[model samples]
Target chain A: MKINPEFVTSVITKFIREELNKFGFNRAVLGLSGGLDSTVCAFLAVRALGQDNVLTLIMPYGQTFPQDVEDAKAVVSLLQCRAMIIDIQPMVDAYFHRYPTDNPVLKGNKMARERMAILYDFSAREKALILGTSNKTELLIGYGTIHGDMACGLNPIGDLYKTQIRQLAIWLGVPEKIRNKVPTAGLWPGQTDEGEIGLTYEEIDKILFELVDLRRSRQEVIASGFDPKKVNLVWEMIKRSEFKRRMPPIIKLSSRTVGHDFLYPYDWDK
Target chain B: MKVVLVQFSPHLGLLDKNLDLHYQFIDRALEEKADLIIFPELSLTGYTLKDLISEVALNPRKNNQLNRLKSYSHKIDIVVGIVEEGNPGLFYNSAVYYSKGEILAIHRKVFLPTFGLFEEGKFFATGRNFKTFPTPFGQVGLLICRDFLHYGASYCLLAGKADLIIILSAAPGRGMSENSGFTSSEMWELMGAAISRFSTAFVLYCNRVGFEDGVVFAGGSFIYDPWGKCLLRGPDIEPAFLSLELELEDLRRARKTWSFLRDDKPEIILNSLQNLLAKNED
Candidate 1:
């Protein structure tokens, strides 16, 4: 499932440019988490709409990794795009202080949504479209907050798996530090994506490439030399996370409903 | 004969805007003095039109826009894809071959791909016939994207003595290859080559480029000669209006050399199919 990174890069940059142009926007805003996915998107966005047109928002919570923040800053400096450090700690903590949630997942989800809110705010202020950074792996497993990191005006890397994103990141000449780092959501201290997902992206991507892209059955994927439990887990995750990949289904009462018979393309008439 | 392939991205559900875009390209083709101009499937109404298909469906018999497009055929033979409203509620994904201010032929797409990312079967009525019409270049056959994938469709055209097969597609770009191009695009090229070589017909594929709800159409429109040699290829994921001078003499030479058409036994195959169908029914 390896991709021609150069071919993919050209397609994505053109996609970003044309999609944004269709919406009459020359500028784009994306949250930079110092992760490979976001970093690659930043590079592509800068390539499509000049460095001056792309804005990077580095929003870190109180427990966010310092190295990640540094890496994010490094990328912003490297790309020479507009960068803003908006600490989401106060807003997330303020909400938690009022709501009183001790659960890490709840806190993490709050942090993600807070960052999304700030990104949109900046998007409105800058009149730039918010570019999504969630890769296919995260999207398939529903590892992202529904309306948080998942919310964006356009996504250039949603079809690419985590492994493919790493491949693309390497081709894009992303920093070795950023490329080699363990993938994480940076929601809490000492948290890694593989740890939470119960499998490495390498393993997850293989199973997903079969189960999703190739449309292989769980048994067929296991037969292809994957661990049965992991294959089953990946299949289950894909099935369970279907909601995260789509709009909320509207109950159709009228002849033409928004998400039903009244379907139109997102770029319709624009 | 010179052929111009207008590889363009149509604004989804915007008929008038896409018409304007078509006119722009048509004018360009005319300026180049091309004999034929081909556009990708649903050139007037962008692909991925789910419910919007009905909104954009054109009755070619009476539509003013279609009439205007047909008017250009007086100057150059134009082949364009459109949402053809055959009857009141029945629509077909169709390719119209316009020549001399009249539609010479309308090939409704036989294979309406409904599975995977496509929902054409849901919106369009499946076409029944595979017919070829005479063109100034040669006898030509038209097939939409999915129709071209079914070898039987090409075979039917070959049987109809088609010397040129034009495929109009809004094929979504998918499957990355380790090498230079998309896996989906490679499949098209492979099929185009095989069909061209076997049928001894020039295969022209015109595919659109642009994102429709995140599914981007691969715009690697290409032309294959009668000998299955690629003459021209448009850029992937980008809009291009490419013109190619096709040596019509190549068709005569390839046909004489291979003689696949001359050595064909359609009668035996037809009899075999009829017997098989009769037996199956029994």
Candidate 2:
């Protein structure tokens, strides 16, 4: 009867801790994006591994919004956790010059990947688990950059939808300003998520829930006026991005494959 | 209970030929003092039977074949694949587990492959759930080739449910590789791990060999312990009977070393599988 934020956070935090213990890992590292998703993950990680155990890293491009940095600082200060802030603008610019692309999506992707490279470098240095912050909504829509914002040793919020992210952020006590900020990657100037997509998270959330959570077909989704084009857009995105969800597609040269040919997920060598 | 795996090759549409081979295997198993003998998927007729399967399907009420199998059940249990004759247009690629003078259980193949070299969907329907039949040794779970691949079957079996997982496979050699592909090795390992990690139980995979309609049957039959350790594996191209001595202590030792059932995140596993399936469905 009581659907509350703390209840969700408590459940999520306990599960992560138990899974880590089961996996035989003691500490975890999380990228502190200063966004709602990452803030919630940071809070959960703290409960899972303690303030001393969960290292927070804030990697900012020099071009990143000032508010984003302020929010990252707020998380570190409030959680009383150790954090390292690294400016990647110079390094990313160097690569960008070589790439020479006007495409924002491609550029944003490269930045995301660069941040992950730094995150992994820190993970090796600290010997801590890389905790991912992408929520189910972003993952489902293929919104986050693969091997970038998507790279992590384990994901905690990968199943929760975007609306669920807002709720959990409130439960985790992420600062109101960051929580309410137009869910942006802070990839470019004058950018809000809906500005590029032409539809707000609320609408996307409703359509996605109706389609996936409720198991509605394409026709049913269209009948509901969720925009046949948008539904098709989401479908195409998922189809094209499936490669990201799985291991490199099996090139079957043997009697069986790990994926489709002789399919099984268990490691036989063990 | 001593479980005997009758991993034999079934020629296409040759019911009497396959049944005769089954009779020989069953007789040998009985003489060897085994408590039960199991066969691969579609053992009465091979997998490539397709539409012809429904025509040859023995009507259940008027079936003399199953009634014949019931006579032998007083001595030992038998789990064999059969066409459980349904209505005129419907029949199941079913594994009929018979014991004590009656059919104990029937599990239909759920993951029917519609694409690729196989076209099983044209012939049979998918089963809805994992069915477990009780035995003196433990509750036995039955599955066809693709049914075992559904890892959710592992969770359902682990809920203090089954002690033996009997898989009847005409298991084709498709995308299995040692490192990164589909191979018979992957299926064996997954099934072994599922049985081992889920609880104290033995997994028996009886896969047929030889080509059926150009689909090469990979004859890698095996039995696994509850710890997921391989108890036995037969040759990849032969009709062989593989066996392992299973005792309460053996099950107990596996349970002690790693109590996977005790440590399982049932709720998490449930959610993860759902999300995994949902993605695939999309």
CA-only RMSD, every prediction: 1.7, 17.9
Q: Residue-pair clashes per candidate, as listed?
A: 0, 23
Can you tell me the DockQ of model 1?
A: 0.76
Interface RMSD of each: 1.4, 20.3
Model 1 chain B lDDT-worst window of ten: B174-183
The local distance difference test score of each candidate is 0.90, 0.74
Model 2 chain B: which ten-residue window has the lowest total lDDT? B175-184
lDDT of 2 by residue, A154-247 (tens): 7887767777788767766777887888888776877877777666777777777777667798789989887888887766766777767777
Q: Which stretches of candidate 2 lie over 4 Å from their true place?
A: A1-7, A261-270, B1-282
lDDT of 2 by residue, B70-114 (tens): 777788888888776766667788888878887777787777778
Residues A1-270 of candidate 1: C-alpha lDDT, one tens digit per residue: 888999999889988988888888999999999989999999999989999999999888754488889999999999999998988888877887889977888888888899999999998999999999999889999989999899999889999999999899889999999999998887678888899889999999988888888888888888879999898888888889899999898888997788887767677775
B163-235, model 1: which lDDT tens digit per residue?
9999999998888888775778988999999999999999999999888888888899999998899999998
**Candidate whose DockQ is highest:** 1
| Number of the top-ranking candidate, with lDDT as the measure | 1
In model 1, which runs have C-alpha deviations exceeding 4 angstroms? none
